[model samples]
Target: MLRVKVAKEIREKEQLGDELKTLRSKVKELEKSLSGLKDEHARLAENEEKFRTLIENSTDLKYRCDLKGRISYLSKAWEDALGYKSTEMIGSKFSDFQSPESIKFDADEFLKELIDKKISSYEAAYISKSGNIIHLRFNVMLYRSHTGSERGIMGTAYDITGLKCIEDQLKQSQKMEAVGRLAGGIAHDFNNLLTAIIGYSEMLMMNNLLPENAFQSADEINKAAHRAAALTQQLLAYSRKQVSRPRAFNLNKLVNNLDMLLRRVIGENIEFFTVLEIDVGLVIADPGQIEHVIMNLAANARDSMPNGGALTFETRNVNLDEEDCEKYPEVTPGPYVRLTVKDTGHGMDKETARHIMDPIFSIMDPIFSIKEGGRRTGLGLATAYGIVKQNNGQLRVTSEVHQGTAIEIYLPRAEEKIEKKETPQRKLETEGGNETVLVVEDESAVRIMVGTLLKGFGYSVIEAKDGNEALEFCRQNKEMMIHLLITDIIMPDVSGFDLVKRVIKTHPGTKVLYISGYSEEEISNKGTLGKKVPFLKKPFTPTVLARKVRGVLDRD
Candidate 1:
């Protein structure tokens, strides 16, 4: 019986040992799992830290909002962009910082984009702390819970202020091109008509057969036609299509010349002051057009202060650099002459000032004056804009409501020395020779008027209605000793340039005289030697025509 009891104790001890080994194995496995859990927790903590660092340092404006569009969290970029601390921005609605136009667009259009798309992007204008405009491009996505239920919205924004400025400038450029096309076409046609009217009126006034009253009527007609011609020139100037007679001239000299006229223009009630800087740099531009620019600005300044205020004109030399060019991409970096005109009168708003210089806006809104009871024409600013641009210059305006207005025009400095005005030339005979001349003009009235003038000047004249007729006459009368070929620069069938080339082959001895109503620039586009050859501009009086004919015939 003792032996059997010992065997049972041994078996029970073995079973107990087996159970202890199993518990030890399970404890070892649990310790390994705990070590793994610690490592995983450390890795996850490191990842979260990296994400936080990235979000904090990002230049993109990152933000989160609740369903009601309330501010939830914002990154550091918001402060740099808007001059506002994150604390001040927290819990505020995004619309609070937006411009009125942006807010209206978000409510009316952006919400629809969000509803139709999981991610929506939009360009918005936000108001800065200083009331300046900041343009931003927002790329937004719907923030959702793990279960796919919508919780809020989150987005990133990029600064697009500079890009927006370039876009606005491009739009302004396109509008100016359109305006140029429209205005240039009208002016070109009107110039042709004016040439005939003025030429005929001058001839009538010179006629010895008319009564004194008839002479008065002819004088009046000539004056009216000249006025009409001036109007056409203004249209061309504003469209930058006018042929500019650019010469290096002193800006200070021009200011002195305009002093008396400006005094009368500003009236007795207004105070006018001249602050001309001696030895101001010379500028290259059409002096007449620059005068127009000054007159337009001065007139507007006078009208702005109808109740009598101070008007000041300041002239100085400025050296513009890359930094200046950066602010104004339309201008080149170089020496410039700055003409500043200031008025103590009501100013314009930002919106109005932005579009005020646009030619299209000026045309559409003729009565759009800047101040109360102002009679200034809408073309005032636009005319200045075109003239400055044509001269490779810039125009800037700075003003605030209730404050005064300041306009600064920058014209490029000329490298050439200022040339003195021409003295009277040696008088040439106003009689034509017995040489045969061909007059080519499309307009019958203008052609007839030119023919009569040449005939009276003692030249044998042959009138051709068009370029084809002119060329055909030259071909048929190949042996005819054509002493002079007077042809229009721009023609429908054949250009005056082509006619000259072909006629020279047959009549090499013929002296060529090109005439046109088109501006020098336009004529150059049509023919190669528009400005290079002996040219006579249209709207010439009988005396001028007579001198031109004799001068061309006598030239070796």
Candidate 2:
């Protein structure tokens, strides 16, 4: 019995030992779990600090709003963007500062969907303290409590007003460019028809044998044709299709030369004043077109001053910079000639000013006494605007009702010195030469007219309707001396360029004169006529034809 009792006691002690070991193992596990919990708390605190720093220092506007649409938190960027302190905007509803057109999303509707959604992005505009619209793009996310219950909306807003303005300006410029291209296409064909009409009318008026009444009627027809020609030239200038003959000339000198004419045109009732800069920079442009622009602006000013008012013509040199480029986005940073035409007369209202800039808008008042005919096409300012743009310049107008009007024009300054162009010697004799000439043209009327003109000049004229006929004529007349070859630039079967090459091979000594209604830039290889080759634009008067023929024939 004693031995059995001893064995029972030993088993009980073993069981107690096992229980103590289990208790110690549990204590070690508890200590380790406590340590891990403390570390996790420290990590969470550090993450919260980093998030707070990001929100405070970020350039993007950070905000938090309650379900009632009241701002509970606002970033420092509020003051930076909208000129309102964070404290002042903290409790204010976002709708208070938002523009009427800026509410792109419904907050209540978006919040209702947030239980299943996490993130969204949208754009809105806010009215600043300065009364300017501020555009913003916001990236928002739903905020929630640690227990996963919804708290509110938190988002970052990025300022995008500058980008939006630039985008709008670019879109407008592209639209204008598209319209310009369409206008150019129409003008090119229309000008060709005008050239023929003007040429024929001038030829008829040159006849001296007509009766006095007939002469007067022909004179009227000639004058009407010239006006039509002027209209076409204006269209070509606006479309940038007209061939530019750019030369450096002083703006002050140009203004001086037009002073007498301007005074006469503006009338004695209007007082004219000049405030030209003494040493204004030179501008490179077609002198004729520049004069046209000046006259148009002056005429506009005269129209404004119906009764009697002062018209001031001013000029100065300017250096445009980055800020100027922003205002005139199409202009580059460089030196420019600044011209201002100011009139103290009946000024235009904002609406009238805006409409007048369009080429189609014209004011019709028969009793205005503005123009000689008292009928304005309303294209004067439009033409001036177009010419400036074609020359890589800028035109800006400002006006206020009963205050006055000012028109400012800026043209890029030319770097090169002005060089005198050589003029052809005058042929005092009103007679023709005895030189043999060949004319090739596709148009029957043009061909006949040219042949008659040359024959009347006492030249032995050879005519060909097409290139094939011209080439055959050359084959048959290989022995004949053809002193000059006047051909159209473009023709059927063979181009003028090809005809010239073939004719030159046979008649190596023959001079060539290329005539075309198309711009030299359009048909030439590098926007230049061939070296040593004479060129005459179509719609030439008899006098111009005689001078060009003599000039080419006399050249060594």
Candidate 3:
């Protein structure tokens, strides 16, 4: 019995040892698992350090601030860009660098957004440590602790000062372009009215209706009307609506002849200098337009100098090679006659110089502090630009504030020697035949004036208010022989061009004369008749209208 009891005790001890060994194995497994976890943690820590280094050294400005708007930290980029040490700005309020005008409202709005939106972004200007204004696009988010409690605000800001400046310049340029187009349109119509008035006045003066005293009054009216007409022509030139009769002409002769007039116009206070190069090559341009361009430029120079200064007009021969064409895409490679107008006056700033050729730029002189009286209508330079462009020329300007301004016009030399066309003698006056003529116009005054003028010329006249009426009249007169058709370019129902086409189709032998206040190019584009058809520009004098009608009717 004693031996059996001792064996039981030994068995119990063996069982106890087995349980202890199993417990040790379990402990060893747990230790291995912990070691693996520690290794992974270390790897993660290294990756986190790399990420922090990248953020701290990134070119983009990275920053963090407390919920109360006090800056906690800023990346090295901010310090490098804005000339600020990160340590010096770390404890400062974010509003400290903001513009005072926008600070309170902007700060309040931003703080509210941070609390409500979790993320907010904006573009704003900030004052740097160097007192320079820097534009920045800021993207910020509210940071939260692991427990979901708000900690601080963090953001990245990108410098955008250069981009902002370019955007502003673009906006100004667009505005100037729009205003130039508007001014050009208005000037075109105004020119037509002035043309009619001046032409009629000249015809009336030839009538010999009054004594010398009355003649002076008529002369004054004529002078004033002519002056106004000249102004309107300038406007038309600016609008690119002016009819340019380009011919090869000697630039030297033109400038020399106009020198005296230019000097007189600029007045004695301002000194005028002409650097006319001897024997400059002939240029293909309208002489009247070139004259107007010179006059307008001289006037502008005069105004620039309230306290008299030197104005120089220089002419030279230049060969525009491939390099010049590359630099100025608008110019072609050829021999060119360069006309430069320089002025020693209060020079224009970059902004003003950029818009000098804009029709409405002069209007803003007061606001921009470029000029005081603002008496000079900015149309002068715009007209010069348009005329130069129409003549296949290039205009370039250089100006420095307080130094001076220089404008250069490069006109291509005439390629071919233009033959002079002799002017035909005026036709002998003749009583009109008994043939009927159709006159179509939209404006009643213009229509009546035309009818009266046609009657004075002794042609039997039939008038229509519009194209539809004109068409009806032609249909009704299918049997009657209509000698000539005088019609306005623009009308309701059917345009003059369409009516002409329809009439020509029905009455193949019918003759048509187109009239318009618009440029001849504009009238021809109506598809009326081919370029072979003649166009009479409005507003025509009674005699001029009579002559045109008679000429068309008598054409072979």
Best by TM-score: 1
Cα error, residue 291 of model 1, in Å, equals 1.9
* Tens digits of lDDT, candidate 2, 394-479: 88888988888999999989887764564786564445799999989877777777788778779999999989999999988889
Q: Write the per-residue lDDT of candidate 3 for residues 1-556, one digit (tens) a residue.
A: 9999999999999999998899899889889989988998998999899988998879999989887778988888988777789888888876677765544435566778778884478776778888767888889898889999988889899998777755765575466456646755665566456545655555456567567777677668768866676666666677666778888888878888998999897789999888888868789888888888888888778877878999998999999998677646557798999999999978888657777765565445453324356554446576788788778898877898878889999998987665344478787464455568888878666676677656756778999999888888778767777788888776767998888888776567878888877776555566644566878776555566677777777889
Q: Write the per-residue lDDT of candidate 1 for residues 330-441, one digit (tens) a residue.
A: 8889899999999998877888788888876676774454445645464678778888888888889888777878999999888877555756788876676788999998
Candidates sorted on TM-score, descending = 1, 2, 3
Best by lDDT: 1
Q: Which residue pairs collide, candidate 2?
A: none
Residue 62 of model 2, lDDT score: 89
Q: Is candidate 1 or candidate 2 better by lDDT?
A: 1
lDDT of each: 0.83, 0.78, 0.76
Q: What lDDT is obtained when candidate 2 is compared to the true structure?
A: 0.78
Residue 257 alpha-carbon offset, candidate 3, angstroms: 7.5
